[model samples]
Target chain A: MVGPVFTWIAEHPKVFWTAAQQHLVLSAAALGLALALALPLAVVLLRWRRAAATAIALVNVLRTIPSLALLVVMLPILGTGFQPALVALTLYGLPAILINAYTALSEVDADIVEAATGQGLSRAQIVRRIQVPLALPVIFAGIRTAAVQIVSAATLAAFIGGGGLGELITAGMGTLDIPQLVVGGLAVAALAILTELAFGLAERRLNRTRHA
Target chain B: MNWTLANYDRLFTALAEHVGLVATALAISLAIALPLGVVSARRPWAYAGVMAVTGVLYTIPALALFALLIPFMGLGTAPAVTALVLYSLLILVRNVATGLREIPHEILEAADGMGYGAWRRLVRIELPLALPVIVAGIRITVVTQISVATVAAYISAGGLGDIIFQGITQDFGEKVVAGAVVTAALAVVADESLRVLERRLRAAQSERA
Candidate 1:
């Protein structure tokens, strides 16, 4: 099993490299896009309890939709390709990022906010100097969750021509090609573990800075 | 609408298979996680070790795990269930361990003073107290597995995913909508029902307190 996979890797180094690169780019782009949309929306939602509640409820429903379904459901609407895949993956990532950001901001110690208010910090200044720093750890935790999840879900993008490592896995399955399957599975698994560990270390650092 | 009416039988069969797949995997996961969780809860090193192993298993992508299993397990419900069970362990075990570990020391002391042996105390008191958290974990596991199990259809483990995959390949919008809708509904129903059970258990615990 191992020998065959290694031989395949050696024979088609470019194919393996391109798939790995595509997987990374897809995962990264989705995480980046999710953060961009979710964070600002989370900030806005923080000030509105009713809207936050509704948005979170909607996200909860969205979360129940299977990742594959979410990807393919985009076919009719967005058509197949990297763009649709990115959109679906970003939506997959939204819940954790949005919920965590809103909760982190809202859960900042009320007394501290009061002190900041008394100190005459403007709303924007308080958000920048006080709320954001304190919320960073929790928000980072959410980001870590989103990052790991997005990486995993990005594999499904291959089914729709999103061109990720999933293509290798799917092709392997079609042909019962053990070498392709092993290589693809191992690469995706390695990427996911690496993402988890990287974010975990960053999260710990954030916590330490918060404490210090 | 017309497509769904024409294919209701297919839809129902897929939904049933999806439910069965999730149910069987969850049952096996709970059985394994409960004992492991209880044992690990009492031993910090064991907890860490078990978590480390399960965490890695949980980190692997669903499709990747399924792909890896195909050569060994062969495609079908078995490999799909195996993957689902593995994915669920991290969530269920962590929650179970945490639940058991969170029981107040004073409560355990009182149980001991009442002449309850370790086995009896666990069954009669600690497990009950921990029920809410365990149920909460089960809720998450079910919802997540529903989604994962849908993807299991790619391996020919029959489910609503079969319908969705067919729709994707055929470019049939109605089939995709039907599959997604039913899958989401199953998830929501499972989640809400487990949530109710969790809430009830919490209420009972608080009342006892």
Candidate 2:
């Protein structure tokens, strides 16, 4: 057995760290932009409930486009930089967040709505102050799913000349660098796990504090 | 950007491989997950463990998963299909287990009263009732695999991605568009067809009830 992927690690600590940093940043950007776009879309769709099914179906199909295919599609237009990768990743990241957010808001307790109406709370105020807070947990769960998925998919960015831990994986594939490939794979996997666990803990803490 | 017969054969070949790769992986995932799902349904502890393992596997980047498998399987179809199968497990297993678990308790009690054994009840009653949910999972697995199998080209597994990648390298926008459109179309078709199947299965169960 060959020893020490540690040799590669020890020799290029900065490179490894930088790649990991890039992967996280890419994931965050994709997830944040997805949420920013999706949350409002979700809110607006709540009023226009008649069109929600059609809208969700369209988003779902957009999501079914392969992440790699989407990346290539971007290359011709955005021409192979972080911009294209970000756009593709953000699009790839949208369906889950939007669907969950919409569902969560729609499923808010009718009694709560009735009570708010009884109290003279305006429709906008009730949705903003009451429904939004209650929907947070479900929406956060969607964000958690999108975040973890984006980290893995963001690795495809390197294929199109974007920077990420995928750079390590691609570089390794080019040069037959076994240790490099494994390190990149493990790092990306580890990041996904850590992200999910962190979100899990945060959600629990949020739930506990709110209940208390 | 020209539409030409020169690339039609290549696109069709790629589409065939893409479908085969996706089909093979889904078949294998069903064989593996369906049983595991059944067992897990009976044991909360097992269900949790299955969820954690498959959930983590699903999170691995499709490219990295293929690359990791390539070391042992040495590229081509094996590693690609292996990765896709692993990816399918999270959705399939969870849905199968949930489907089985969510079956009404009264139905189970009735089956028991009629002297049904475990396997008999499962084969006759449980499975039919579970088909709608199970099919929903299959639809997800199929559509996701269609997207995933396109990336299989990077591993030399060969799919519609060939056109997309070739188009990227050769600067043929038409070919790229062709590949992407076909890929998206495959996913949509599979999703809708399976959804129809899901509804039918659900209808039969409702009619029986």
Candidate 3:
């Protein structure tokens, strides 16, 4: 099994590289889009307590939808390829970041905010200097979770012509090439683990900074 | 609507298979995770080890895991259930351990004062208190597995995912909608129902207190 995997990798270096690159790009783009959308919305939602709770509940429900179904659901609307895949992945990634952001922001210490205000910090300045910094670690944690999940889900992009490591697995399955499938599976697993670890480390560093 | 109505029998069969697959996987996962969780609960080193291993397992993508198992398990419910079971262990074990570990020490001491043996205490005291958390874990596991099981269809595990995939491949929008809608509904229903159960158990525990 090991020898065959190595042989397959050696034989198809370009294909393997392209798939890995696509996987990384798809996961990264989705996380970026989700963060961009979720963070600001979370902040705005903070001003409306009822809306925040309702939105979070809605997101929780949405999160129950499987990643595959979410991805395929996009197919009818966007008609396949990277555009649909990214949109689906972004939606799939949103709930974690949004929920975490809302919780993190709202949970910022009230007394501390008052103290910052007492220091004559303007509302914008307080948010920029205090609230965001305090919320950064939790938001980062949300990012880590979304990143890992998106990387895993992005493999399904191959099914709809989104071109990722999943393509190899599908092709290998079609051809009954066990080694090829294993290689693709291993690559995807490696990417997911790497994303998780990288974010874990970054989150720790963010914590250290916040504490300091 | 027309497409779903026309394919009602097929849809129902697929739904049954999907539910059966998830149920079987959850049962096996709970059986294994419960004992492991109990043993690991009191021992920090053991808990750490169990979590480290299961965390890695959980991090692997469902599709990739399924693909990896296809060769060894030969493309059917066996491999799919195996993947789902592996995916579930981390959540179930963690919840069980946390639930057990979080029981107030005074409560355990009180149980001890009542001459409750270790086995009896665990059976009567610890597990009942931990019920809510364990059920919460099961709820999450069930919802997540329901979603993941759809992808199992790719490997001949047969579920609503088959319809979604078929729709995508065949350019049939209605099948995709039908599959996606039903799958989402199943997940939401499972999550909401379990949440209610968890809440009730928590309320009952507090009432006992």
lDDT of 1 by residue, B101-200 (tens): 8999999999999999999999999988888999999999998899999999999999999998898789888888788788878888898899888988
lDDT against the true structure, per candidate, is 0.91, 0.86, 0.92
lDDT of 2 by residue, A59-152 (tens): 8778777777777775666787788889889988898899889999999999999999999999899889999899989988888888877887
Model 1 has a DockQ score of 0.72
RMSD of each: 1.3, 1.9, 1.1
Fraction of native contacts, model 1 = 0.65
Docking quality class, candidate 2: medium
Tens digits of per-residue lDDT, candidate 3, B1-209, equal 89999999988998999999999999999999999999999999999999999999999999899888987888888999999999999999999999999999999999999999999999998999999999999999999899889999999999899898898788998899889888988899999999999999999888988
Evaluate residue A112 in candidate 3 and report its C-alpha lDDT on the 0 to 100 scale. 97
i-RMSD per candidate, Å: 1.3, 1.6, 0.9
Of the pair 1 and 2, which is ahead by DockQ? 1
DockQ, each predicted model: 0.72, 0.63, 0.84
Winning candidate number (TM-score): 3
Winner on DockQ (1 vs 3): 3
Model 2 per-residue lDDT tens digits across residues B1-209: 45536777777888899999998998999999999999999899999999989988987778778767766787798888898999999999999989998999999999999999999999998987888999999998998898889888878899998788788778877777788878878888888899899999888878977
Question: How much DockQ does model 3 earn?
Answer: 0.84
Sorted on lDDT, best first, the list reads 3, 1, 2
The TM-score of predicted model 2 comes to 0.94
